[model samples]
Target chain A: MTNAPEITGETDIAPPVSSTGIVAWMRERLFSSPLNIIMTVLCGLLVIATLPPFIEWALIKAVWISPTADACRAARGGACWAFIAEKHRLILFGLYPYDEQWRPLLAALVNIALIVASCMRRFWNIRLLYIWGIGLVLISWLMWGGVLGLSYVENTKWGGLPLTLILATFGVGFAFPFGIVLALGRRSNMPAIKTLCIMYIELIRGVPLISLLFMSSVMLPLFFPEGFSIDKLLRAQIAIIMFAAAYIAEVVRGGLQAIPKGQYEAADALGLSYWKKTGLIILPQALKIVIPPMVSLFIAMFKDTSLVVIIGIFDLMNATKASLTDTAWKGFAVESYIFVSIIYFVFCFSMSKYSQQLEARLATGHKR
Target chain B: MKKVKATAFAVLAMVAAGSVGMAASPALAGATFDAVKARGILQCGVNTALGGFSAPDSKGEWQGIDVDVCRAVAAAMFGDASKVRFSPLTSQARLTALQSGEIDMLSRNTTLTLQRDAAIGLNPTGVTFYDGQGFLVPKKLNVKSAKELGGATVCVQSGSTTELNLADYFRAQKMEFKPVVFEKLEELVAAFFAGRCDVYTSDASQLASGRALQAPNPDDYVILPEIISKEPLGPFVRHGDDQWHDVVRWSLFAMIEAEEYGITSKNVDEMLKSNDPNVKRILGVTPGMGKALGLDDKWAYNIIKLVGNYGESYERNVGSGSKLNLPRGYNAQWSKGGLLYAWPIR
Candidate 1:
């Protein structure tokens, strides 16, 4: 430790800390004030009370595999990981044919790789478009394989993580373009188009998504002409698209309305056509500004995919729920739910991080 | 001229409405049986998860009484038990699923109430299980009968048949009791186990399963002897199709009659050679039974071979052969002092 210089009237000397290590830092930050000390001690007490038992239950005392609940009970009541170890495949794939699970596993991994690759700033190019275009073709081919000598797997057979991804990604992808169209039409001065847009938005937004899904699953089939049938999965996908598009239209409309009048005036002065003015001048600026809210909406919709459990889609949430139906593992819902929650958190957390990065990259006009 | 045009408009509207009505009730002409045959699979709706009724095993294969019922129908139709798709449904979605034609039939544990049969346009094919609402109490409570729980605080799921039955039973017996209501089965079970209530009330099958599967000590909880309501859980189809209804109803009846003739999945082939007329008729050794249901001559034999008799299913699923271990009390065959009586298969 360095010694303090001798005190003199000519210059001021800062006093040396008694302990100049982590101990000193802890003293200043953790116990420097009365409230701080109290909070720290209380938190320490809480950790002492909860942490060891939790660690013991989750790790140390947990059962790895057991044939029955009797075995789980013969050991003391800790986390019955034996249940998870036994049922993890069922939780991950639902009722997908066991032999063909490699297809869905490949489909899910391809989706994740595409998602991760797209999040990279360097991959933000026209080449990215080609990658997605080709990747989707491959994924579709792999998932619904009738060609290439692979056995035909219907869309109804799709379940678990792949189903969740298919629903969210397809729902948001369709909603984005549909929303833009509705927003533009709503802003259009043409009376009939604006009225139609308003009616659609209000109608979809008026009812809960559950009722919308129910109508699609039930009422739409009855309404269909005799001998005509639609797939149940396709019906649910359409309902999600309709519900999300209405909400997204409102968000895009806010972005469009926020575009300054100066941009419109500038485009008009340049003798630009109406399409050019809106596409180049207005939408480019408006879409950039709305990217944050749009990403948030996408995240919200990702969570809303869980609601399809009500309609029996066997998405990740429902598959996890289905896994716990085993009589051997009947009481261990907490562990199963916690496992699925972690999967959700990982996807959502990465999306949030990507949104922040995109915001920073797109901060062009807000230099000051 | 204006009056004539108005009359023409009314006639056109009536024609359109009549066409839609005809389309809706196409099943009235026995279309569902053909539709199911053309589809090459029977669409069966079942509970999301119930221990003795319908639940997915570790292999993601649904195996229980409700699941087997549908498979039996599949066997009767195609002579193969695997030609069925299970649509797992919540309680709220079950009837809507059947009504909307999403499923051809529902073998879920739905109580066959008069209102359900009439208002919801459901035709109860046959009662599969004679379940009843009952109470469960901790061993420490020392309550041997539901009668002693007059002033007890009971935990029950709100807005369910169990909740309504509990209130009705207390009122009918002229007893005073406090009720703790939870909207979820997990919450009610938790509350009861956490000492928040003195008694837990639900269907006896559910209570027995809950205690066996979830209680800290299975021996600590005992279901009360008094059963208050008749659940009469059964499979049902939409109301317009009596032909399809008979197909489903007689499929179950064949199983019951198979048990009466002592023809199990194991011995069904042997029974096909029996000289006894009843067993011969059930095994389709004697012909003419399948034409009425528009099925093959070996329909009963297929169900018996692929699935099992009612007694076998009972023993394998919810009775002594399974974890729930529910007794064959009211569900026993007619000759064995139980209410399960099927019409003669012949």
Candidate 2:
């Protein structure tokens, strides 16, 4: 039995070449059982039935550029992309001065670059924090231009893609540390600190973000002393930070709780201080365990920035909505909404991919 | 722009909303006029998207009747209409934005009502457009009258005055109708277009604007003749700033006055040479009116030059000159047998 098989390299020759490209894989999985085959065939037929007419309606016969709504309504029955072409500027930058739109364009680019940089494995160190901090400062200067010899654009005029990025990036960035503090406090032995953290987290989390935004816009003025005015953007920022912090606290707490007690005990045995024990020994592992959920929370926060429209902050969604008011491009909301959806999807999908890559990279030697 | 809405729902009354301005503001808080002057750009709150009311044009310039009110205020304050920055506010957020000083004035087609003025802390500058709640339905429905509709599903904005008015109208007419309410106007419009509801109810002006702009085929819809609620839509500001309120009120009154005097934008320069004290006062050649309003003597001149009179702004945005082609009806001047009457510019 031991000598039955020859210990030759050629004996391990390529196994039978069973057709194994994507097509074969699809055939094996999608058409494996009768039920699966039937389902796949039905789906294929459905797509076949719907796809061409959809393509014709959405692209081939679509009007790319036209002067008026009637021009779009003429001849070909398809989407009027002319609406988007005419209104794209308003949707991209809101009411920002046409001459100085480059400032917002660059600000949005810088933010996107910073987010991309942060997503890289090499930038996962404290250097990432520095990059983000400096990047945000630069973006702020770019957007609210009273410095660097740039023409001043008031915060009210700052809107569209840049506004959405500012709110989401700042909201998530500010939330991470604030969330960590709340999480640590919730886990602390000190009763007062723990209770305070619990109260804040519960209070903010209990309410919808819309109310927080409303209070910031509406009720906040009543609380302020006369003669002092907080900027509307700043008020909304504070609301977003507070709201996101509460949700992030709950997420971070879950991570902190997952850390084994043995890790803390070991750090304590080594005469480590509480901060060192948590920060060095426990937090790294706990945070690693939670990267997936944390990124999911981040994605959710990014999407939530659209809600600022309710408060009159002309973010991307608001700008898109504002563009639809033009009589020249009325009754073509589907095209506009789809384009906005694609914009949102690109950011979210990248975040998801980055989270997956991070999870793989973090697996390392900590299998236990 | 930041507090959570759940906590907000609990404290709906903004307790000192009305009284705080009346009782506490004059001591030191009436700063909107100064703020507008200092900022150099009057922050005017307008509708996020209302056809013929306030909406951004393709080039990102603000347009429409409500927007003209904002331009008038800016011109009155800064002697330049372009010195205004518009904040596109939602119906729900407009009053809050004004009361909280997020905007110096709201020209967002808001209806003047006792509850709004007293409870929400807004002082109506003046009525800009006399509108009324009405119904819009597909022509195929063959419904000649709003009263004819029984068992029809009516779409109304959830928090809008139209919801209550629709209910009242159907009840008063002894008609059975289902109501479909949506939070966003976009959703409501889409629901109507998709045939989810038989009739869409709003102020009649909006119904016409929606027909001309939002409808796939403008000819497919018909606005019903019945006008239910009296919606005297206008610009407003926080109650505390009487100086700002006066400026807003009179600035609007200036437009009406200009229309009354027949001082068209085209003839404004020629009218400046008129010996009539009325034209002189309106064009600011009389001097005292502007000084009384805490602005330069050229304030009304700037308004006429930059934003045009009530009649011009109306026809350009919502009436004959616009796609809506709506009849002036109640919006016509009192001299023309409509409700628009102006206080004489003495």
Candidate 3:
């Protein structure tokens, strides 16, 4: 190789750093091509028209606290955040016993902790599943008492932020596995089992949540034997789980379909049982591929949780509305609405961003 | 107070709302009146369903206390009580619709509040019915007083004063309770009966009305006697339009004034030719007062002749003659120690 040839020119080491500055970035991405320039201008105008007033209303001029409605003065050109500050507790806690609220708070923390633990790549194992089970049991035990010398509280009295968290956590936690089983069953060669699963998924997906909740609340009682009644929260929870399962099944089915036929043949070549092959070979890759869609589903479920307010379970939105009905804060609806909207937007936007990140990570592994 | 709007499209019938009469745009307040007159109908807002308050009868004709208020206003404006179009609104949508100028006036069973007047930019003309919030629990619960049920779950409409009252009542009793809320009264009531909630709380009259609609047996539930909060139901007009407010306010006052003056719809014409100065002044025999309000002197006469007096409207809608069969407890005439007092027409 002639000793790697002689050294190159002076410019070889640093070809050209192309001016690293805002102006350079602006020129390259925003003004380099005609299409890019047009898109930038369009986006700029959209931001100007939308973002400034929103920022002004939501942050810059918003009153963080006010003793009376006069302090808001809607004409004064600012949001009345004080209304939310005053009633936020009521909106978040609903009818939970005041002193016992610590239980729900602790429960919420545990649930959040479990979710965080599961998200860490280092802890992504079957043991992580126990976190959820333990967390749910601890939460219910903490909230419902009747053990450990704590006073027992009924589920019906559960409302506010705690109720909302419980519904969403339990809803997705139980729904995921159920959805996977349903998807597998639907795709199975067994015609009877497939038909039953297909019918179930379709029927649940066909109706609105309101009707399902109504059926659970009203028609469910009629179906059960006399004196064997389900609690309102349980009825609503079951309806939510069933509703979520149908959607999740469809998503999971897509993931399963994306697995190549060669993988199945390779698993068969290993002489593995059907369950063992599918569980060890197919599920791991399929679930990884479907992470983005699953996250999006979670965000959607969060929004749908608001509908529970309509049926009398005082979720976050319901509690906000309930707090506004106070004669002391009668005209502070705009403030209250904005606060809850912020809460919803923050959670949903973060989830969507996380989903995007997961999609990018997953994309790196799949060259095709 | 039950304030059903009778004339939804009827404002156009008697008013000569020509192209040049006024602006036809909805953005302007008075312009809507011109539009209604041009369209030859009054756009009236009423309740969709509330027994005896503003519900349709067997033949589908709207009847109730609120309906007669609309009819009275329509009769005053158009000289024809039946020349109205009824638009029903849920409680949540009522204020927004009126604020947006979707309807001329809201004659639903809307409560009068200072917040509605100063904050929401709507004017309360007068109280039509004096109601109070109360609780209704199923008989199986065996709860006689609301105070006894400390931890009970209550079903209440999402956006009403009743919700606040429920919280305050329970809190004052040092009892903690959960509330299941719905945006619609019908849905809330249905949920209550379906056993989703332990108690149903609302305006006492509404509790009675909801109970009546329940099948199987209405007697399975009982409305508690504790009156929690004062709910002075009334008609509302949009703010910034003093003339329209005056018209709506006086139209309601005219009914009470007519009842006080013993002027019945059956003999309003005979009273028009009477020698009594009060009757003649109210009947427009003395026309100068109408000039001040920018209306014809015959406005009160048109109101009485078209829609009956206060007592007559109540009896026809919510009292003994109607399905609601609600007694005229606090809605009776001022002479009978009730609150239906009216200022002088002249």
Question: Cα deviation in Å at residue A66, candidate 2?
Answer: 1.4
Top model by lDDT, which number?
A: 2
lDDT of 1 at A49: 100
Query: What is the lDDT for A52 in model 3?
Result: 94
Report the error of model 3 at residue A301, Å. Answer: 1.3
lDDT of 2 by residue, A1-368 (tens): 46677668867777675678998799788988999999999999999999999999998999887877777767346988888888777888887878888889999999999988977779989999899888878888888788889888888877788889999998988988999999999999999999999999999988899879877876776455444669889999999999999988888889888887888889999999998988898888888888888998999999998888878888899889888766555677888898889989999998999888888878976555
Q: Write the per-residue lDDT of candidate 3 for residues A319-344, one digit (tens) a residue.
A: 66656434234445667777778878
Candidate 2 vs 3: which has more DockQ: 2
Q: In candidate 2, how many clashes are counted?
A: 13
- Candidate 1 residue runs with Cα over 4 Å from true position: A1-12, A16-42, A122-129, A365-368, B1-30
lDDT of 2 by residue, B1-346 (tens): 1232332332354332532223222122457888888888888989888767888887667889999999998888888898887887876666666765667888988888877777655788899999999999999999999889999999999876689888888899999989988987777887897889999998887787777766777889999898999999999887667888889999999999899998988999999999999999888888898888898988888898889999999999888887777899998999999999888887
What TM-score does structure 1 among the candidates reach?
A: 0.91
The global C-alpha lDDT for each of the candidates, from Candidate 1 onward, is 0.83, 0.83, 0.74
Tens-digit lDDT track for model 1 on B102-140? Answer: 789999999888767775557899989999999999999
User: Which residue pairs show collisions in model 1?
Assistant: none
- Worst lDDT run of 10 residues, candidate 2 chain A, spans A220-229
Sort by TM-score, best first. Answer: 2, 1, 3
TM-score for candidate 3 (chain B):
0.78
